[model samples]
Target: MNFILFFIVACALTFSLFREILKRGSDSILLTVWKFFSYYTTLSNFLVLIWFAALAFLPSSEIGQFAQNANVAAAITFYILTVGIANYLIFGWPKLSVYERISDLSVHAVTPVITFVYWLVFSEKEALQYSLIGYWLIFPISYALYTVVHGKWSRFYPYEFTNVQVLGLKKVALNAIALSISLVIGAASFILLGKTVGRL
Candidate 1:
C-alpha cells in the first residue's frame, strides 16, 4: 500500500507541476517551478511523497525509522489534513479543467485522507506525547515565517491570509495566531486519539 501510494502521489505531483509549468508558459522554468513549489499544498504533498517512499523502500533506514515514529507520523497527518481543510474553507470548489481537477483532488483530498487513515491504523501509538505538539508546530510556523519573508521579496503570497502586502502585518499576525491555536487543538486531538486507539 505504501508503494502504491508513493506511485499515486508521485503521478499527482508530477501532473500538477507540469500543468503549472505549462499554465505559466514562462521562459524561466526554474522560476515557475519555484513558485509552484511555494504553495503549502505542494509542500505537504511533497512531504507525503518522501514519507511514503521511505516507508515503502527503506523501512530499516534512519529516515524511514524517523517517519515511522508516532509523533512524526501524526505531525505529517495534521499538515496534510490542513492542506485539504484549508483549501476547502478558503478556496472552495472552483471550476477547473479535467487535469486540474484530478491534480487538485489527488493532493488536497485523496492524499490527506489516505495518509491519515494509514497513520491511524498502522502507526505505533505508544510513543505519542503532549509535549511533542510543540515540536510538530515547528514546520507550520517556519513555513509561515518563510512565506512572509519570501512574499515581502517576491510580492507573492500563496494564501490570502498570509498576504501581508494587502492584509497588513496586524491582520496577518492575527491569522497566524489563529492558525497556530487551531493546529495546537488538532495536534492534541491526534495525540488523544492515538492513545485511545493504542489502549484497544
Candidate 2:
C-alpha cells in the first residue's frame, strides 16, 4: 500500500515538473530548468522523485546509499523548513482554505517525513562520511542568493523572512544568515545521529 501511494505521488510530481518544463518553450528550457531546481521545495521533491524511481526499478538495491550524505542534508533541510512553516503559522494563520491546507500539508509535511523514513530504512551507514558535511550548504546558500535576486525583479518572496521588499535587504540577509547557520547545525546533528544508528 505504501509503495503504491508513494509511486503515485512521485508520478504526479514528475508529471508536474514535466508540465513546467514543457511550458518553457524550446529556447528557454535551460533557464527554466535552472529556475525550477532553484527552489528548495522543488529540489527536495526531486530527491523524493529519485527515491521513488529507485525503489520501483531497483527493488533489491539500497536506494538511500545512492546519494547518502546529500540525501541526509535534503531531508534535514526539508524538515527544518517544515517546522519553520509550522512555527510561522502559529504566530498568524495564512488565510488558506481547506484545499490549500491539504496541498501544503502533503508537500511540506508528508514528503519530508517520507524522505526521512526512506533514509532510515534504505541508506547504508558505511556510506556516510564527515567530509561531506560542508556540502550541505550548497543548496541553502544557492537558494538564498536566488531568492534575493529573483525577488528584486519579481517583488515576490516565498517566505516572510526572505522577503526583501517587506523586510528590507539588511533584515533579509540577517534572516538568511541565521537560517544558514541553523541549517548547517541541523544537518550536522542528523549526520551524527545517522552515523551512530548505522554503527548499531
Candidate 3:
C-alpha cells in the first residue's frame, strides 16, 4: 500500500471510529477539536478513496502536500455531485428518511457502484495480496448472498472476473473456486493469516 494512501485511509477510519466522540462530547475542547477535524478531513469516503487510488497506482512525489489537498477536494466534489445526489434522489431529502422499504434497496444500488469505482481505480494485484480477504473475497460473497436472498438486481454486479460464466453448474462451481483462491498466494501464508484473521 502507498504510504500517502495508507495515511489518509487510516485518518478517515479514525474519524469514522471517533464520530460518536465528536457528537456526544460536552466540552469546548471536544467541540473545537471536532470542528477542526471535520473541517480539515471533510470526512468523505470520496477523499479517502482518492488517497487509496493515489497509493495504489500513482507515483510518489518529493512534495505531496498539494496532491493530498487535491485528492480530498476531488472526493468532496464527486461526493456532492454523484453519490450524494443519487442518495438524495432515491430517498428524498427528509431528515434521516430511510424507510425500510427503500433503505436496503437504495444501499444496494449505491454501494456497489461506489465500491466498483473505488476498486477499479485503486485496487492493485499487489495490494490485493495484502488485503485480499478484506477487499476481494468477503465483498463478492456478501454481495452474492444479498442479491440471492433479497432478489433485487441492483445495477451492481459482484465478481467481475467470473461474471460472464453462463455455463452449467460444474463450470460455474469451478470458476467460483478458482476465482476465490486465485489470489496467487505463496504457499500457506494466506492460510496462516486467514487462520489468524478468522474466516472471510
Best lDDT goes to which candidate? 1
Candidate 3 accuracy as TM-score: 0.23
Position 170, candidate 2: lDDT = 91
lDDT by residue (tens digit), candidate 2, 69-131: 455544553444544354445545567766555554555566666666666665665556557
TM-score of 1: 0.95
Best-to-worst order by TM-score is: 1, 2, 3
TM-score of each: 0.95, 0.68, 0.23
Winner by TM-score between candidate 2 and candidate 1 = 1
Candidate 3 positional error at 82, Å: 28
- Candidate 2: list runs displaced more than 4 Å: 1-8, 11-39, 58-65, 68-96
| Pairs in clash, predicted candidate 1 | none
State candidate 2's TM-score: 0.68
**Model 2 scores what on Cα lDDT?**
0.63
**Alpha-carbon lDDT, every model:** 0.90, 0.63, 0.39
What is the per-residue lDDT of model 3 for residues 1-200, given as tens digits with 9 covering 90 to 100? 45544454444445543543544556565554544333212333434455455545554662343334422323222332333444455557555423432442333233324433543344331211343333324433443444333322332222232233344446645765774464323213533432343333
